[model samples]
Target chain A: MYAFNYHKPATVAEAATLAGKHADGKLLAGGMTLLPTMKQRLASPSDIIDLSKLGDLRGIEVKDGVVTIKALTRHVTVANSAEVKKAIPALAELAGMIGDPAVRNRGTIGGSVANNDPAADYPAACLALGATIHTNKRSIPADDFFVGLFETALGEGEIITSISFPVPDKANYQKFRNPASRYAIVGVFVAKKGADVSVAVTGAGDSGVFRQKDFEAALKSNFSAAALDGKSQSAAGLNSDIHADAEYRAHLIGVMAKRAVAAAK
Target chain B: MPTVSMTVNGKPVTGEVDSRTLLVQFLRETLRMTGTHVGCDTSQCGCCVVHIDGDAVKSCTTLALSCEGAKVTTIEGLANGDQLHPMQEAFRENHGLQCGFCTPGMIMTAVELVGRKGHNLDEKTIREELEGNLCRCTGYHNIVKAIAAGAQAMGAKA
Candidate 1:
């Protein structure tokens, strides 16, 4: 732990200003990811700009067909919100199923999506539900938000204000949890809005979170598990580890997509 | 060294710690609240669980400086002198502990679970919720019982 400056700003403008001042400033959200990286000496910022004190950054509001969840909104908060549950129970269920009780209590929807952990659950929700990552600057579509494994479109000094998830007619997420980490070795989120079905897979891919166009196309034809009974995804870009192989992950993409469709039943 | 200040286990404390001092280290080494154990540094283990403004968080992965001006409740805050918190009581009553290493984290996690969603809770829900906070001792049998009982007790108390 090298010496560094710390600042807790009350407003987003002040926070952004502070971020701009420090050369190696890092926005401190829940620190589920940032703190550990710092501890491991993987990251060392010159200053830490704490966002927890920023009141304007926390809340969940559902208006019209849009579900806007503030960046600071905890997974527990989102999971328990009556409005969120009513508008999109699948999103609530996804939040409720993050890691465990401790992780969910502290981990924010913002932090989870920003970290862009390949094994995270929120990215699947973001991609499948066609959410918009609203930053202090502009809105980045979900398709463009996640750049790569452990990467996102977010830049230094740029803060994510909130995410806008479009309310879908039918949506569900099914994950095959890794035994040790409880992370999705393979998780799939299927969102159907009107006639379009978006299938996003997380946890079991080299590309972090991604859409299965083949699965989506098949499901759009007939939104059922039977649709995936004869189709599968390509294994070229999937992840392989002791937990699971690339081929298995590809297999899981098809299986979980089917299960997710059935779960949305 | 960075000057860190925060309220922990119902007490206001101040200490000059390193810039990278973890909340768990600050609690154990500086503040000496050893009840919150540090099992793993990778944020995987919940043994260092504590409530940062009533939210159960892995202390090992939390920076002490980041918790400035925030209220933190540790495992030691559960018992009121002699009476155990309902979750602790349930753990004791159900023989939910074996090694006792994971109890503090288990109680904290259970407290968080009820705090999050009490009405929407069931046995299956409880089992699904506690996947991250691992307890290698109990084989999760009695731990599940303890959490269920604690949830029931917490609901009754609520």
Candidate 2:
């Protein structure tokens, strides 16, 4: 790993100030992805603004039909939180499915959302549940937050403070994970609230996680597994790799969506 | 270089290290505590699992500077002097290891698993919990049995 200056700030303001001071600085949330990238020399930042010491950016709250999780809240914390489980059990289940126990202990939701890995599970939840990402600067809806693979709408020097997810009436997530990395080869998250429904697909999109409008429309009418019968997801823009071809991922997306719809409560 | 101080194995230790220094490197190099091994430095392998503030984490992927004032427990800290930890004893009794390269990490992960999941761990749960710790020798059958027996032993002690 390349040598860099590490700053552990006690406040979000201080962390942002440190971030602005360095042109090539990276915010260290739970260093699950950043540290590994640095170790491989793939990302060599001049400064690492460690956010672990920012006490205010660590919590989980449920209020007014929304579940608010702070930036530094670890995956394990989200997975095990009584409030999260009671409010949004599918969100908790998705958090628990990420990587393994040790990885979950250190990987934070904010970091995962910020990194916006195409195969990550959080993006699907964010998009499907219509989450609002609150940064130190402003709030951005999940639809506008994720721009592309490994990218977000976060500007330089801006820090994510918390993410607010509106609790859906019913939601579920199903994924066909890669055996080695455990990343989703094709994951689907289905959410329905009142008459509105949303379907988000991750790990299969060429541009990144995307909303499956067709599936949403189908479920909006009949909110059932059988509602998606005879519907097919096209492989036109899906990701194809050694693990799975685009056609295979397209097929898995439909299958997983059916399963998610069937399992959602 | 920056100075980092943390409590490891119940002993306070301080060392001057580069900001890029990994916690596993600090333990195995600066402090000369070599019990924690680094199999795959990329965080895929759990050869460097350790407890930080009573939670299991991959030390190789964790920065040393991030652990300031934190309590860290490595594989070397598991046993009480000459007496082995229940997990270690169980591994030995069950012959859970073959190459022994992944034993330190496996034991560390197993101990943390017991702390969280408790003693009544079933076979499926044991296998599922051992996802991060990979045994190259494919000695998982005995490893699963050892973790179950070790969890029960730890429960008896408690």
Per-residue error for A252 in candidate 2, Å, reads: 0.5
Off by over 4 Å in 2: none
Show what share of the native A-B interface contacts model 1 retains: 0.88
lDDT of 1 by residue, A76-160 (tens): 8998899999888899988877777777767788889988999999999999999999999899999999999988998767889
Alpha-carbon deviation at A122 in model 2, angstroms: 0.5
lDDT of 1 at A177: 88
| C-alpha lDDT values of all predictions | 0.86, 0.94
Model 1: docking quality category: medium
Against the native complex, each candidate's DockQ, computed on alpha carbons, is 0.67, 0.89
Candidate 1 residue-wise lDDT, B1-158, digit = tens? 76878988779999998777788999999987799987877878688888888878888887787788879999899898998988899999999999998888888988988886773467787877677677887788888888889888877877
TM-score of 1: 0.91
Cα-based lDDT at residue B44, candidate 2: 81
Cα displacement (angstroms), candidate 1, residue A240, comes to: 1.3
DockQ of 1: 0.67
lDDT of 2: 0.94
Q: Residue B137 in model 2: shift from native, Å?
A: 0.9
Instruction: Specify the highest-lDDT model's number.
Output: 2
